[model samples]
Target: MLALASFISKHHPTLPITLISTADAASTPPSVTYRRLPDLAPPQPPIKNPVESFFETHRLHKPNLRAALVEISEKSRIAALVLDIFCNAAFHVSAALGIPTDFYVSNGSPGAAVFLNFPTMDETLDVDIGDMNDYLHFPGFPAIHSTPSKTVVFLCFGRRGLHSAEQLKETAVALERSGHRFLWSVRNPPGKGGDVPNLEEILPEGFLERTKEKGFVVRSWAPQSEVLSHEAVAGFVTHCGRSSVMEAVSSGVAMIAWPIDAKQKMNKVFLVEEMKAALPLDTGEGGLVTADELERRVRELMDATTGRAIRHRVAEMKASAAAAVGENGSSVLALHKFINDCCGRADG
Candidate 1:
C-alpha cells in the first residue's frame, strides 16, 4: 500500500494522498500523509475460520474508521477511499460518507483471482477445502549495472516465512552439498520477530567458512529483485509470495517453489503446474526439507533437463512481461483505459 501511494504521489503530484494504515511505515513520502486507525483488539474467542476472523476484526474498526474519514473529509475532499481487499466492512462507511471506494489487493492477479472466485468455489465445491485439490487458479524489473552473469541460485522466503533453526541448518547444508553458488537470505525464526538473527547460532558451525567461496548468507533481508536480475543468479528458491513470483518471472529466473502460506500454495500450483516455470520443493515433517532433498532439488533446478525447460519457459515470460509494460502494451493500454473510464465517471 505504501508502494502504491508513493507511486501515485510521484507520478501524479497534484493529487495528494492521505493514507490510512495500522502502523507507521519507514521512509514514507512527504506527499502522502498518514491517517492511521488505531489497532483493533484481537478477535474474542479467537475465531477459527480465517475468513470470518479477518472480516470480524475489520468490522470492529468501522466506528473508528468512520470517525477518521468524516474528520478528514471535513478538512479536504477525498477523491476515493481505498480499502485493503479484505476490508469489505469499510464499504458501508465509505458509502455513507459519499466517498468512492476501491479495494487494493497488493498481491498480484493470481492472489486476486483466487480471492474473488473463492465465494463461487465455496458455494460449488461439496468437498472440504483440504480435500478439494482440483482448482487452483493462478495467474519487477530493476535496473542492472554491467556485470558478467554467473550461475548462482537465489534463496529467499517472504517476510512472513521465518524458518526454524533446524530448517535453516538444513538449507545451509543443502546449499553446501549442492556444490552450486547461492545467495540465501536468512531471518530470525517466528516469535523472535524484529531481532537480527545470530547467524552463528542459527546455522551449522563452520558452514559459512566451508561455503564462503560459493555461498553468501544475507541476514534479515535482501534486495531480492536486484539479486534476481543479477547475472550470477540462475534460479530462485522462493516461498512463492506474489511479489517474489512476479519478480522471478520478470527476471526470467526459474524457481524451486516452497510455499509457506495458503496464498502462496495457490501460487505454487500455478507456477509448477500451470506455468511450468518452476519445480516444487518437497517438504517433510514440520515442513522442513532435508539436506539431501534440498541438494537434489537444487541440482535439478540448475542442471537437469526439466530445469532447462523451466528456465526456457520463464525466459519467454520475461519477454512477455516486458512487452506488456512497454509503450502501448496490454498493461499500458489497459491502465490508460481505466484512467479514462474513471475520469469520465468522475466528470459525470
Candidate 2:
C-alpha cells in the first residue's frame, strides 16, 4: 500500500492522501498522512487460535471504521479507497459514501490467483469449515537465531503462528535428528500466550546442550532480513507468509513451505507446485508434523541434487524479480498506468 501510495503521490504532487489503519504508522512517507483507528486492546489470550482472534477483533472495529471514513470523507473527497484484501468490510462503507474502491493485494500474483480461484476451490472441495467436528487443515505449511552462512537452516513461524511448547520440543527433536546446523527463535506458543517462555522450562531436557555445537536459539524475535540475506544462510523453514516469501526470493533462498492457516495454503501451492522453488512438509494426525517428516524435509532441502535444482530455480526467480523492479519493468509500468487511471477518474 505504501509503495502504491508513494508512487501516486510522486505522480500527482497536488493530490491529497490519507492512510487509515488500526495500527500506528511507522516511518510513513511525508507525502502521505497516517491516521490510526481507535484502539481495541488485543483479546486476552489462551484464545482458540491467534489468527481467528485477530480478525474477529478487527471486525469489531467496523462501526468505528465507518465513522472514520465518514469523518475523512467530510473533509475531502476520497478518490479511491485501496484496501487490504482481508478488510473487505470497508468496501460497503466506501460504496455507501459513493467512493470508488480497489483492493491492495500485497501477496503479489500467486496470492491474487488464489483469491480469484476461490469459487473453484469451494465447488471442488466440499467441506463445511464451520461445521467441521475436527480441525479443518488448509495445508502447505518456526524460529531461528543467528547468521550462520549457508550452513544452518532458519525457522520462523510468523508472529501469531507459534507452535505449542510440546510442539516446540518436537521441533527441537527434529532439528537434533536432522543433524544440520540451526538457528531457532523461541516465542510464546500460539493460543498459549502470556510472556516469552524460558528455554529450559519448555525444551526437551538436554536438547540445548546436545545441539549447542550446531544450534543457536533466541527469544521472541530475530533480525529476519539480516539473517536471511547472510551468505551463510542455507534454507528457510517458513509459514509461507507473503512478506517472508518475497524476502526469501530476493535473497535467492529456496524454502520448506509450511502453510499455517488462512491464505497460506495457497501460497504453499504456488511456491512448491507452481514455482518449484520450495518443498512441502506433510503433517500427521492432529496437524502435528512428526520428527521423522521434519528431518526428511530438512535433508531434502540440503540434498545436493534436489537442493541444487531448487536453488537454481530460486536464483532464476531472483533475477526475474530484480528485472521486474528495474527500468521499464512490468511492475513499474503497471504502477504508472494505475496511478494515471486513478487520477483520470478523480479528474472526471
Candidate 3:
C-alpha cells in the first residue's frame, strides 16, 4: 500500500492518499496520511495459534473498520474505496455510501486470483482438489508441472508461531540434511510462560555451527522481497501466502509448495497444478514430511535437468508479469480505467 501511494505521489503529485488501519504508521511516507482506528474488540490474549489469531483479529477489525469508513467519508469526499480481500466488511460501507470499490489481492498472480473465483463460478466442473493426479489448466496459461530450481528459500511460515515446535525441529533437521545453501527465517515459538527463548535453545544444539557455512537462519523478520530478487535465489519453499507468492512470482523464482493453511492450499493448487510454476512436496505416510524426503526434493530441485526446465518456465512467467505492468500494459490500462471511473476525470 505504501509503495502504491509513493508511486501515485510521484506521478500525480496533487492526489491525496489516506491509509486506515490498526497498525502503527510511524514510518509511513510523508505523502500518505495514516488514520488509526480505535480498537472495538476486547484485548486479545497472547496468541498461541497464528492461523486462529489471524481470523480472530479479522473479525474484531470489522466493526471498527466500518466506523472508520463512516468517519472518513463524512470528513472528506472519498472518490473510491480500495480494500483488501480479507476485509469484506468495508464492502458494505462502500455500497451504503455508493462509493466505487475494488478488491486488492495481495498476491501478484492474476491467474491465481481468477482460480480462487472458480468456486463462486459455475460448479459443474466437479474436479476433486485432493487428488494429486487431477490437473487444472487455466485459460491463457501453460500446463502445470512439478518442477523447480537449484538454490531454494524455505519460508512456508512467517515470523510467528504458525508451525508447531516439532514441525520447526523437523524443518531444522531437514535443512541440515539437504546440504543446500539456504536462507531460513525462523521465529521463536510462543513460550510456555510468555517468555521467548534464544535461537540456540529453540533449535537443536550445534545446528548453527554445523550449517553455518551452507545455511543462514534468520531469527527475526526477513526482507523477503529483497532476498527473492537476489540472483542466487532460484526456487522458493513457501506456505503459499498471498504476499509471499507475489514476491516470488514478481522475482521470477519457482517454488516448492508446502501449504500450511486453507487459503495457502488453494494458492498451491493454482501455482503447482494450474500454472506449473512450482513443485509439490509430498509428506510421507500420515502427512509427516521426514528429513529424508526434504533432502531428496532439495536435490531434485537443484539438479541439472529438472531444475533447469523449471527455471526456463518461470523465466517466461517473469517476462509476462513484467509486460503486464509495463507502459501500455494490460494492468496499466486497467488502472487507468479504474481511476477514470472512480474520479470521473484525471483532475479529480
Clashes per prediction?
A: 3, 16, 3
The CA lDDT of each predicted structure is: 0.82, 0.79, 0.71
* Model 1: per-residue Cα lDDT at residue 224: 93
List runs of model 3 lying over 4 Å from the truth.
1-156, 159-161, 190-197, 284-287, 344-348
In terms of TM-score, which candidate is strongest? 1
Clashing pairs in 1: 149-231, 150-231, 150-232
Candidate number that wins on TM-score, 1 or 3: 1
lDDT by residue for model 2 (276-340), tens: 98999998888888888888999889664447678777878888889888999888999999999
Off by over 4 Å in 2: 1-148, 191-193
lDDT of 2: 0.79
Tens-digit per-residue lDDT, 1-348, candidate 1: 889999999999878888886676557688888877887766367789998887887888898899899888889998898888888888999999889989989898656766676678556433344223111222211222123463789999977788887888889889998898899999998766565888887799999899899889898899999999886788899999999999999988889999989999999999999999899878898788899889988998877343657776787899999999999999999999999999999999
Name the TM-score of candidate 1: 0.56
Which candidate number would show the highest lDDT if scored against the true structure? 1
Q: Is candidate 1 or candidate 2 better by TM-score?
A: 1
